[model samples]
Target: RAGLRFITCHEAFASAYSDGTAVRVTTDPERTQAEFARCSAADCEGWRSLVAIYRRIAPHVLPFTNMPLPSGAAAFHALRMAAGLRGAMLDLRHVIFGSSGQLVDRFFRTDAAKGAVLPWGFHQDFGPAVKGGAAFAFVAALSAHMKGLVVAQGGADAIVSALRRLIEDGGGTIRTATQATEVLVEGGRAVGVRTSTGDVLSASRAVIANVTPPLLFGQLLPAHSVPDRVRKRAMAFRYGPGVFMVHLALSRPLAWKAGDDLHRFMYVHLNGKPDEIAGTYAQCTTGLLPSRPVIVVSQPTHADPSRAWAGCAAMRLQVRAVPAIIAGDAAGTIRGRGWADIKDAFADRIIGQLEEHAPGARDVILARHVMSPEDFERENSNLIGGDCVSGSHHLDQNYLRRPFPGWTRYRTPVERLFMIGASTWPGGGVNAASGYLVAQDLLGQASKKAPQRGIER
Candidate 1:
């Protein structure tokens, strides 16, 4: 395997900025309490409420671990209990509600006078996931506080290299630049795959697809081979709002008005009032770019200097809740042109916003690469409109109900065909829970089928 290392940092550890003020969140409960105590009374109360809710849910959910549990009634009951509710019916909105019967945002408005809610939407992709039950978002925040953040020492490429080495060491061959055109099926069983170059690679055991449902059902598989109902579900699979990313190579590190703490934390969220965050999501859903969108500024060079050249920095600006296809601009400044035409102007607007928080952000940029939603789809069809999560995490499409009902265990109706990746349970993120679970299932089946070691049939 490739010799790679990882750098573990505190999870849920981020510095949130609004206007000129800032608040740093960390894993230590006492430290978090002490930090917020200096803020307004309302801010303190809001932070306490979020912590309280997390505490209540922690015992029941065990969000950090990937232990397998029963998928039916027992799972539902445990989830409901974790949210501190007593009933069969439960959703994300119910899970995050405070004692006042309102959402957690009602309690945790950082700038109460300015009406700024905590930017929970930063953890989610779609508008509904932001507007509705942010149960997963809340769990993610709490888990970060509990587990701390873990990153590869060299970078994410370190992970790819390690996996590549493992595959090669195991005598497995990886064909790069090869596109799978169709899944060759024989008698309702997946037998092999036909590549774009017309090479048929047969599968000995199973065909595991990491692509989206649409690509799997519509393009890769024979239309008549799949059931009508399953096909319909794939067609109706909802995708979340796409992402707009700006990668920059900076001549120097960012100079923020908030101080060096900004450089310490890995993620800096730039947002305004809670209402503005909500409005931005609403606008994106309607195919319009928000006048003021929430932006995530990350400086990897701070964590690992090797990422940048000497005396230089490597940074990324990720703007959330942007539309995949542009119909209008809320600021009414950038014309509603296609991504190719408007991406640069949009990047300029985003950079201007960054400059507002970090005064010297624009001056430090030596080179920049912009990846709009369109670019994401062009590069990887799985993105399907630049949705990094693959599919939406709405209530209907989450948990055991994910991908689609009746096929949640990674098995498909077609024999020897399985599915995994972000589209499966334990939904999105860098975690390989889906792949791990699928591997476990396949190993279990293989063990069951193997003949006794001493006495062969």
Candidate 2:
């Protein structure tokens, strides 16, 4: 970078991946128009607040839609005109709190029992944006949980050390890197793992899985090992959208139009509504760009000073629900451009969007970084499709049903192998709730095994 230098990381390490993307769409177009008309007048003041927000946060989200009007009556009338012109207006608040009945509708198809739907408001994780400089907003959720907890960090060594401590506390012993190549089966009991490294770890009691259902039953374990019902359930499992990220280094501090201080709301761009986001997803399936891609940006230098040049700030832009490969086999050949050029294009687009809000923002940057899905996969094997959250946060694939039913625990189909990645419960994030949960299970299992009561199985 021309202006940035880092003391810790050779090149300051910064990553951006879509943590959240919300949409606004109406199944019935006419009704959508009617709602807008009514909202314009009664919520005129709120309307101004919304547009001002978009303009101030431009390049992130533009407040008002097509027929921009200064007054309530005008907004009400303009909404209809814009709709006819294919311009859809949205309220950012609605994305987080509004019930997309559509999302609820999708729950119906999730293969749960009839009438089984994701209980609303239960899908949120407090840690999504905290690492990106949102500690002030999320600190409450931690203390709010009355039952206190402790955490230890150090990565691979830390995980093993924590496990050993739990074991000394009378927890369980772990099999490290056995790679559960297969789940050995004889009489229907899970048995154990046949690791790629040629080690077989067998289970006399229960075998827990550290991987997702796809990896567990499909790859590690043979088809016969899974019961018919369980197999079908696993097959029916669905995943949410993946992510795209862009990292940037600038010669100057990122200045937002709204306020100099970074606001806690994670930045999002909704130039197009739900349809546009879906179109992007569809294109991703066929390897094409969607109608329009959504991006989320954050000014990390705004929070951690160590990320950029002495006076300059660093920023990250992200796209979610996008195809990892777009526009002519995006993989293998990056549209024939080097990574730098590709990243600059993305940054340029973001800056163009910024012009609406902070005009002339593009000139401030000095360096850039961009990562595709392949890039993400290369960096962190845990992030499938570059989605930092592991699996999509869908209802069934979340919480108890995650990675597949009946295997939320960290123990695997093998005896001592365990998973401590984001694929497990309390899914994803640096919080490591899944790891903590696994540790709890291990502690309990070890306590039960310690006395060695004969024939307990």
**Highest TM-score scorer:** 1
State TM-scores per candidate: 0.89, 0.52
Clashing pairs in 2: 54-63, 207-412, 208-411, 208-412, 209-411, 209-412
Candidate 2 per-residue C-alpha lDDT over 253-360 given as tens digits, one digit per residue, 9 for 90 to 100: 655554343222223243323333334445555655433454555554433455556887666666664545444432332353233345445445555655454444
- RMSD after CA superposition, every candidate: 3.6, 16.1
TM-score of 2: 0.52
Q: State in Å the error of residue 440, model 2.
A: 1.5
Off by over 4 Å in 2: 1-209, 222-224, 262-288, 325-348, 355-358, 405-424, 451-457
Q: lDDT per residue, candidate 1, 112-209, as tens digits?
A: 32222245444566342343345654665556666656667677888998999999999999998999999989999999999999999999988999
Q: What clash count does candidate 2 reach?
A: 6
